[model samples]
Target: MEYIASEALINARASTVWEVITDAGNLTVWESGITAIDGELRNGGTIRIKTADAGGRTLRLRVQQMPGEVMTWTSRLPLGLLKRTRTFTLSLQAGLTHLTVKEEVSGPLAAFLGNTRPDTSQHLNEYVHAVTNRAELLDRAS
Candidate 1:
């Protein structure tokens, strides 16, 4: 399996961070490379995402979440040939919120897709930064 992860300490409450992340409409504002999200982010929901990196292609994913604690989005190829899972975790540390975002790809076809997969390290970092900024800004406004 191959994975990319980023972590940040956000100057906001866990609830604020979770609210920012779970709102699909707000994703385009903070999630780097994502242009649009077509669907809600909720358990058993499906969303189609348009990204700058996909050349106008849309990626569909299934959503599963534990409210403010964790959220996972899974995208899979037919017959389990390839699967990608992106998880977001939020926790309170002292007076700040600790956020971790990770994406893992695995399956029988993972080796094949590895060559085609674009490096997402920078994207993940930008996402974390944007989220932290947005959440902190909102936290202050409240």
Candidate 2:
């Protein structure tokens, strides 16, 4: 499996950060890489996200699991040759929220596409930064 992940400690409540991260309608406000998102973000729901970095490919992801502090979304490439799962986890540590976003790709095509895939590491970092920055900004405003 090929993996890309990013994490950061945000000085905010876990619930506060979770609210901002899970709200599909507000994703583009903080995540500059994402141009738009359609559909809801709940267990069993489906969401389609359009991103700038991924050559504007609309990622249709399903909400595999969504609990209070963690959410998992899964997507499959054409012909089911490749599958990708992205997870977001949050926890409170020492009065700060530890946020993590991780994506794993697996299947027959994973090895072939691993090297040619877009800048996943950079995108992951941007995701983390956006979430943390938004959380901190909202925390201060409240």
Candidate 3:
């Protein structure tokens, strides 16, 4: 199991950040590392996400769940010789929103990730950047 968690202090309120984060189509705006997000995004709905990291490696991900505050996905990529289960959790604290990303992968291919996950680690930063970026975007939108 591998976990990467990042928190950010947004000038905007948590609800504002949550609205931006929940806008599935804006993944590229805030999370530049992700190439695309597709499918019906709703509670218990399955979706497919494509990620092209800074290294320009395109990876495919299948989302498992996307209920409020909790999003789970599965990657065919191996992590410690097992299929990886990734989860993104969002919480509101004070005026800021906290996001935690968790992953567990087991498979021979998972070895590709090794002990370090560049994409997942990058995602931690993305979460933080996304919230703050959205806050500013929203400010301008208003």
- Candidate 2 residues lying further than 4 Å off, grouped into runs, are 78-80
Question: What's the C-alpha lDDT at position 139 in model 1?
Answer: 97
Better of 1 and 2 by TM-score: 1
Off by over 4 Å in 1: none
Query: What residue pairs are clashing in model 1?
Result: none
User: For residues 1-142, could you state the per-residue lDDT of candidate 2 as single tens digits?
Assistant: 8888999999987878988887887888776478989998888999998998778688899995556588998999788799999899988888899988999999899989956888988988988998899989998899
TM-score of 1: 0.95
Measured by TM-score, the strongest candidate is 1
lDDT of each: 0.90, 0.86, 0.62
Higher-ranked by lDDT: 1 or 2: 1
Which 10 residues in a row give candidate 2 its minimum summed lDDT? 64-73
lDDT of 3 by residue, 1-142 (tens): 4445666656665556656655678766665455677765555556666666436554445655444477676656334355767676767777566666666666666656675566666665765676678676785677
| Model 3 worst lDDT run, 10 consecutive residues | 52-61
* Candidate that beats the other on lDDT, 1 or 3, i.e. the better one: 1
Predicted candidate 1 versus true structure: per-residue lDDT over 1-142, tens digit per residue? 9899999999998999999988888788765568989999999999999887777889999999999999999999999899999999998898899999999999999988755766677888888998999999999999
Candidate 3 local distance difference test against the native: 0.62
- Candidate 2: residue pairs that collide: none
* Model 1 Cα shift for residue 18 (angstroms): 0.6
